[model samples]
Target: MDALKEGWFSEINDLWPGIAVSLEVTKVLHREKSQFQDILVIDTKAHGKALVLDGIIQCTEHDEFSYQEMISFLPLCSHPNPKNVLIVGGGDGGVAREVVKHPDVEKVIQVEIDPAVMEVARTHLPFMAASLDDPKLTVNIGDGFEFMKKHRGEFDVIITDSSDPVGPAECLFQESYFALMKAALKPNGIICSQAGTAWANLDHVTKTLNHCRTVYPVTAYGIAAVPTYPTGQIGFVLGSLDPTTNFREPIKIFTEEELDKMKMKYYNDKIHRGAFTLPRFVEKALTSSHEIPQESRKEL
Candidate 1:
């Protein structure tokens, strides 16, 4: 891997107090050259900072609620009564924050490798940063994969919010990780992960989705439009223990009265269901179910 400093700081004119940031060109110089997928670490901010791989915006200044809320709540809301939740690779504590919102969630264990991310998020992004301090949350700074190995059949929901398939987070995009995650889930548990960009990373997204199908009986995919992400596109892969779970039905998840109480920024029954409505091209790509062998995926 190589590093090159870019004009990232200059791009963001409005710098905040105590905000420490770093941007470097990251490379994987093996058989396939994926130069755009560089690793970026922004720390020393009011909250803790983060490391983002590829061009995808793993976390941002504005609203992480939209991403974390949708990903965690999608399966959480569906669960009859979720007790414990395990978040893999979400060091920033965004997902943990939302998971605890459920009245029934007793404990939330978040395993993130980078401690810098937790610090930056807590210091800078207050809306989400404070999630790290939730009484029901426990922070674990280490490899999420290794944590999964130690705690198999532990959590009712496991949400993977790692960066795109590149740099340090590349391993999370593999089929083996999905299998490991399945083993880490309780019999009634479900898993949701940020796959990749639907536009720029169709192959990566499809590959993850296909792999999920091989592991979980119930698997489906969804998309979101996050401005900071590459081409303003984001996608998620969902897996469950049951073989036949459908996400399309029930446009209205809550009563009009309940909707008023929980008026969210980006997600609703309509938006949640619409997020799964993929484009024709994506539909076709998903039709041909096959893993993108590392050799062939690298060629493109």
Candidate 2:
């Protein structure tokens, strides 16, 4: 089995049974049990340095840009004027790096439950942690839930860069957390979260969408290809406070020159629109406002 292979480190995702992704570990760079979860850093044979939290790969040096750019830019671009942004649980600093790239963004406040995640990223994964030092960004080491509670209706865009829904991150995927996100946003504010792997966790996607519908009238789903994540694809759930907001269309489309300046890798206006066009099975499972009959369900 891959788990027992020599010089290999593997993460077995319980949600996805009978599969484990392994990497050729050159060395164990760092390991610690933080206040919240187990944080690990390793030098890999293929993906360069990797950040693992609670034995799950969160991001790798090679493909980190895909996740950081998509999650940060999707909601920011969809909002009319996202001058203020809030990031919950992205202690690694990749999301903060992308958020500060927008010239229109005046401020970004990140709340991380565990400071060790950021410290490990800084010491080992410096590339991903570089933006933690941006002047416009503030790193708050506290519970995101309490932070949002105190600062209500203050943010234009909120991004939840949480880990999967288990252990320390389990509460982040619950309905109460969605309600907290709604309260933290302005009237026209937009929010996006790393939902899960739709192909493997369709039930999780459906539950998140149902909770979002109860709060935000405008809710949409998007997916990105991240090989390190389970099923080689991950999904996002977006919700907008504005009733008429079209999550498919980004209000602020960056020029190619601007994208180059921002050092963006995977997020573009066209990709933003295309991400919402889900597979038939996924669409049927997460169709927010409609119910398909049994006969039609099989056809799809």
Candidate 3:
């Protein structure tokens, strides 16, 4: 993939075409060809430790909380009770760590396809992986799709912490995956998935949101800023079985004391509402006729 060159790691993929986000690497901590994909752990000069999968930067110690916290709390706080939550793909344990912090979340079940990612994270990224062994979490090594099929209408919330739509994670963005999640959720259940950056992949985001709208009574898209990600932004596709679901408003607003106790770094009641406020171009693209002209697909 030519990712590491001249002491720098650049994320170059056909998914985002010409643009690449590079980080200055101080040392290569670990690298391996796992059964599923290539995994690399590096200690960067500034961003601290970073987990890379298939030439893509999954998370860095510097800005991972923004993505992990927003993705987990956005759906968790929106639900009246997110007691039994299911995480589809978060091998680094960041999402699980954030989900268990919610007072309403009693139990969490995480399904990770690659065991090597978990092993690497546990060894190299202790800060994020520390909660993997929490009593409230059950770690299962298997495919999320097959797991959800057997346990139908079981969870109150399902958060998918998948990578970009490529390689092993390609199916996670498909319409069939949304259908299965809908079947796996209980009445009034909410589901959220990584929907990529609207600045670079608006068409991809729109397509996923459209797929979600087919099975969900209420659907909305939200964004978070992660500097390492393409275009310095990432978005989520959220949907709920309840018709009254409002993605813009949090059903459970945490007090300042609660936020301090939970160690929330990026999520709050106000941030939850602001995440849904899309830029003018993105708003038009998602709400307009489900067609993005090829000429308009340029990166903003």
TM-score of each: 0.76, 0.94, 0.95
For every model shown, the clashing-pair count is 13, 0, 0
Per-model RMSD to reference: 9.1, 3.7, 4.4
TM value for model 3:
0.95
lDDT of 3 by residue, 22-61 (tens): 9898899999999999999999989999999999999999
Q: Global lDDT for candidate 1? A: 0.67
lDDT of 2 by residue, 1-300 (tens): 147698888989787777788889998999889878988889999999999888899998888888899999889988888999999989999999999998889999999999999999889988889999999999999999999999999999999999998898889888899999989998889889999987888888888877776677778889998888778888888988777688788889989999899888899999999888899888877764334343322110
Residue 218, candidate 2: C-alpha displacement in angstroms: 0.2
Which pairs of residues collide in candidate 3? none
In model 2, the worst 10-residue window by lDDT is 291-300
Better of 1 and 2 by lDDT: 2
Candidate 1, 88-136: lDDT as tens digits:
8776677787777666789999898877666655654566767688899
